[model samples]
Target: MKSTINTSQLITLPDGRSLEYIEYGDCSGTPVLYNHGMPGSAFEAQVLNDVFKDNGLRVICPNRPGIGRSSSLSEYSLSQITQDCFFLLESLAFNKVTVIGWSSGGVPSLWQAKHSHTQISQVILLSSYSHFAELDQAPSHFAGQASVLKQVTTRFPALGLLACKMAGYLLKYMPSLYFKLLMQHCHTPDSDIIEAHPHYRDMLIEAQKQSISQSASTLFMDLLIQFREWPFYLKSIECPVTVFQGDRDPFVPERIGQHLADCLPNAQYHLLPGQGHMYWFEKSFQYRLARLCQI
Candidate 1:
């Protein structure tokens, strides 16, 4: 499959901030708005390009503010970010579309589903974060680390900013080392999946590299926002929602997914056995995409 990396386009929002995005797969097919992960960019969607093409689906993947070439915001909320996404959709004349959020991307995706239920046809969350209230119930290691980071960042914003900058530097300069360190936290299945697919590894590395190509301020802001209390209620989302969680995912354990599903009024929970956080890179994800296409 051809790389979608070079197909990125830019649009100027009403506030004069530039938003960078990429459109891949069947352009005229069913539109799907993809909200990439926190430390991700439009390139994250490259891994699903083949599935998107085979399923005749169009993907609109955008880089959040301060990531890639998108203009950074000194102050922004999830609601404001959601508005940016909708503004792009409105500019494209896409009145209704399926929304998919992976990891931290799920926060804004949930906001989109809640704030604009009339325009959202379906919502899919992949190993997404639920409310901060559920953090205590998550895996101890993941929850503890998250809690510490949130506390540290809250108490010392400069330290957090420094850490984000260091991470960005590592991603840009020593991506292999960065990937190696990142995989240390992954389950065996996630590492095995990446080892088995060299292309997927490359895609992930490229995505990470692009994520902070501009700066690391976005990463810092993303974590800060995620750690804070979400402004909306899950029960407010009345649209059909699907939550896919890997039983072996270390970052977002199955319990977190279950909690998110239980909170949503109309959500179906799917627990994939033996899968990890990066399960989307596995072949099974294509089958899931095919089934979603039938909806």
Candidate 2:
């Protein structure tokens, strides 16, 4: 399938905030809301443009506040972000949508499923973080700078903000080194996949660049929110959810996905063997998505 790269469009919210978003695939096709990962932006959706177009899926990927061209908020909750998404859907006249949340985006996606169950048809979480408390319980299970960053961000936010700023600087000025450092702790498959696919690597680099294009403060707050306790219970989400996790993922443990699936009343967990965090870019994922949408 040919790739489609649509320019971002902006929508002004009732609260006077501008939310920037990118659309992919057929305009009149099946509606989908894609929640990008942390250090990611709407551009992340471009990686899957071919799959979306092939499956006749209309994907609406929005940049969270403080990312991309969206208006930054001093104080915002996951619920507010979810509302922003719903408002965008309303403006687009999309009454129902399938939500796909990757990494940190899963929190707000779950919020959407819980709060707006009527409008949400289904949800898919890819290598997503479950809960901060869950991680705290088994600190040893997760390792590397990501774990340390979470701990620092939870206890010393000021330091965390500084760290995020440094990361943003690296992403903006020294992306090559930034990615090199990032892949240092990644599983072998993850590194190999990135090295093999230049498009995928470029997509990720661009997403990270856009993520901190405005400021790193929002990124810090995003991390803080993820570290703190979530407001909703997993069991409260009535919509069917499918959780995908790579067993070799270094950042998010496979058991976390299982635990999340166990909590949800209607959720299925799929563990991908010999896969890593970047497994979503594989053909298997595209096939799964096509099957799920019954295309």
Candidate No. with top TM-score: 2
Q: Candidate 2 lDDT, tens digit per residue, 116-195?
A: 94788899999887776755565354644446767899988889999999999999899989988988979998988887
Clashing pairs in 1: none
Ten residues in a row with the worst lDDT in model 2?
137-146
Would you estimate the TM-scores of all the predictions?
Answer: 0.92, 0.93
Candidate 1 vs. true structure, TM-score: 0.92
Candidate 2 wrong stretches, greater than 4 Å: 1-5, 134-147
Clashes of 1: 0
Model 2 residue 91 CA deviation (Å) reads: 0.7
